[model samples]
Target: MSTKPSLAVVERLYLADAMGAPLQARLRLSLCAGQGIVGDRHAGRRDWPGQNLTLVEAEEIENYCLSRSRPIDLALTRRNIVTRGVRLNSLVGRRFRIGDCLLYGIERCEPCRNLGQRLADETFDVPAVIHYWTGRGGLRADVLSDGAIRAGDKLEIVDTSGGLA
Candidate 1:
């Protein structure tokens, strides 16, 4: 894999009151270390560690649409940040910065039945949703610093080691 610091821009930001709830688009969001997006349903919930934030690439959605012959809503994915130009999968176990906030990629945010259930009404093939997003769902991250992130913010890979880690 290439060690070059991957660069991307935040394309969209979303938040919701609770799990499985419709997402609300935001131009900006406040995040805290050890907590998720401030005011988000999962914020401060320790039950699921490393779930402080979730990210999905816009390209993934495009690819899914092309492969499935249907369009999927970004909000339905339940990811906090929708990015463009960054390979989120490669960031797993790495540290990255979005705006002023620092985040550590914890794991792949694999698609789950819950996501399928949420799209049940709008989609006729829920399994397809799961299938398409299985490994491309996105990445789960833990906030390392408190700060504000906004749409159009640039993403930068942080060098944790003396060189790329």
Candidate 2:
């Protein structure tokens, strides 16, 4: 068995008013178990249980920008949290704590056509973006405990093996 300790911090947080709306930055947000961010478009939506929260690596965004020779806004990714210094893929099926909230990593948050559409612009290359982001899109989580999370919060890996033991 191995332990993946807390190795990252929440660099940013965002929420959208609706499905097609632009993401707005927030200093903090409330989360409820089995539900998403309060006031978020997807909150209380049963269709995506694991999507209670979405997270993206800050490194992935930096890489995407470097590869494309430009900067991409964090909001365009549609992820609720922009994190730094953690291997999010390694947390799949794992339990992690973000600030006061406890969450279960459900699956990888893959880039979709809608994401591409939202990010499309004269300087944005959809295919290239998708290709670059492939497995690095981020993680979708199911809130296991209700609490408030804020920017600068640390992600602590509570169960590294994701209960495989």
Candidate 3:
């Protein structure tokens, strides 16, 4: 099986620096950069630097995207960065090249209890047990390039650092 990152598209987009914030309910998932993608929805936080993933957990995001009905152009979060066509979890312990930027994948983004609360559906248990999630879903990447990322930009995995076995 080929182990490459994939993308999943959503009919709607949601953004917010904080839970229950106006930014949460008002954001749209349309194809837009700067205002939506590649920037920080939660820039000021010392914990989360860029936009984060919401629906798909880190290890499972790519798989979820692959099985999705339509091709998702990008996945944007409350964090500062936007990812396109790249599965964040698959890049764990690997380095991704986006233009002049090179980001190192740290770990899988497990889902949080907050997700269950936010979703109000509590369907995370099934995926979590399958190793698709750990509880909170998302990823953590250190910024290599300080520029804006859009939907069409290419995401290349340069090195796996003994990863992707």
Candidate 4:
């Protein structure tokens, strides 16, 4: 983590109602711990944590757009939350909170090459896409507490000690 991670704000929120459906931007999301976001397509599919929530850095998205020299929508990243002012990768294995929801960062949300092909333009190719989103994709987290989170809500690191029982 070269960049010092700090408090972040949820810059954008999105949800997909069904498989392969387009991401719909939302002002707020009702999250169910261990069940995922209410009404979201992937909500009840997982019987575990890790994937209950997904977040991507707005800054990284900006960097990718700059590298590709084209404006890409945040929704296309397919992450549940878009955070500003934090290095999300640094949060892996740490406990954080957005609104009243507590979450454990399980792993890095790696880039998808298929989405890369779609994002790639004439000048930039798939290789460039991989190069850009390799480590900057986002985060996959396990929700620890059920709560509602809004787009403008603050994301704070509540525990970095790995949540000792």
Per-model TM values vs. the true structure: 0.85, 0.88, 0.51, 0.87
RMSD of each: 4.0, 3.7, 7.3, 4.3
TM value for model 1:
0.85
34-97 in candidate 4: lDDT tens per residue? 8789999888667545667889999888877766666767876889999998788888889899
As a whole number from 0 to 100, the lDDT of residue 132 in candidate 4 is 74
Clashes of each: 0, 0, 17, 0
Candidate 1, residue 133: the lDDT equals 79
lDDT of 3 by residue, 15-79 (tens): 55554454433233221221222323544333553333232332233454444433433342233
Clashing pairs in 1: none
Ranking by TM-score: 2, 4, 1, 3
Assess each prediction's global lDDT (C-alpha) against the native: 0.84, 0.85, 0.43, 0.84
Model 2: clashing residue pairs? none
